[model samples]
Target: MYLVGLTGGIASGKSTVSSMLRELGCPIVDADVVARKVVEPRTLAHSRIVFHFGHEILLENGEIDRQKLGRIVFADAEKRKLLNSITHPEIHKEMLKQIIYYFLRGFRYIVLDVPLLFETRKLTHFLNHTVVVYCDPATQLSRLMLRDALTQEEAEQRLAAQMPLNEKRGLASHVIENSASREDTHRQVLRLHTKLEDSMDFLLVRVLAVAATAGLGGVLLYAAKMIFS
Candidate 1:
């Protein structure tokens, strides 16, 4: 299976790109979706989080208040690590299960949309390629400020919490320049999809060839044994 890791800085339009890919019929295993699933009320991860951070983080409905938890973790490195420690393993397990489900259904390739793909560096081994949806720093900051109603300082602090988009672009195997119009971004996604489709074809051929060779060798071995007997 071909695994493509998709990431970008906050407000750099990673979600937009993911939506586009999903519209294009690509199966997306989104980390954010898995994240919410793992932390649902009464789940093991959710229970551990409440125990570690106290009951104050829970909402009236009994769900863990994500915004409250985020405020705690994003403020302190140690807290961030603690949160990751509780959730990452469960997230990984779900991601692997989804990947296997796609493979079983004969998907050619799948997109793993992880916002922290570069930050954790744990996903590198699973990815055959990485794509970064990129915009300039100014554009990124402006978008974040406008989207979240944060002041410049607050936006900068949020940006500071993650790896910069420029550096991520340097590490990416593919880039979608989202500073431009949506049409342009769509074109780039389509181009990438074509490449992925081609790679899928190649992977299928390689798997079939290996199976054919093993089958032929097994048949020859059986014939030789019969002759000898």
Candidate 2:
């Protein structure tokens, strides 16, 4: 299977690209979605996070107060590392499971939509190609402030939490500049999808799918524990 990793900075429209791909029927394995799942109220990751950050990061009804936790981690380097240590492993494991499932289902390609693909240095290991959705810093900053209802300083802090967009552009095998209109962005995605379809390798994909099957039983037990505790 061809594994394509997609990422971009905070308000940079990476998610918009993922949605466009979904609209085109691409199988998308999203780390952000799974990351939220692994931290659901009773999960091990959630428990660890609460323990690390304290009860102050929880709501009155016991669910995590994500905004509160974000405030804590984004500003502190050690806390951010600690948070990544707790969450990234489970996210990667789930990501691999989803990829294997899509491969076995005979898909030639799948999108691994991970916001932190570059931050976590995961591109080299997990992807056949990497796509970075980019916009200029001014666009990013303004969009973030408007969308998240943050001030300029607050938006800058969130932006600082990740690598610069321009630097990530350099790391990418493909860059989708989202600074233009949505129509332009859609055209870029369609062009990229066509290129990926042209590059599929059947024999290699089947071999990898077979190899991945061996780990399924192991992660099921691990997943059970994660869900139960």
Q: List clash counts for every candidate, in order.
A: 0, 1
lDDT of 2 at 45: 92
Question: How high is each candidate's TM-score?
Answer: 0.87, 0.89
Put down candidate 1 lDDT per residue, 31-108, tens digits, no spaces: 999999999997999999999999999999999998788778877889999999999888887887787688668777
In terms of lDDT, model 1 sits at: 0.87
The residue-by-residue lDDT of candidate 2 on 176-211, one tens digit each, is: 999999999999999998898888545575664465
Candidate 2 root-mean-square deviation in Å = 4.2
Residue 160 in candidate 1 has what lDDT? Answer: 89
Worst window of 10 by summed lDDT in candidate 1: 220-229
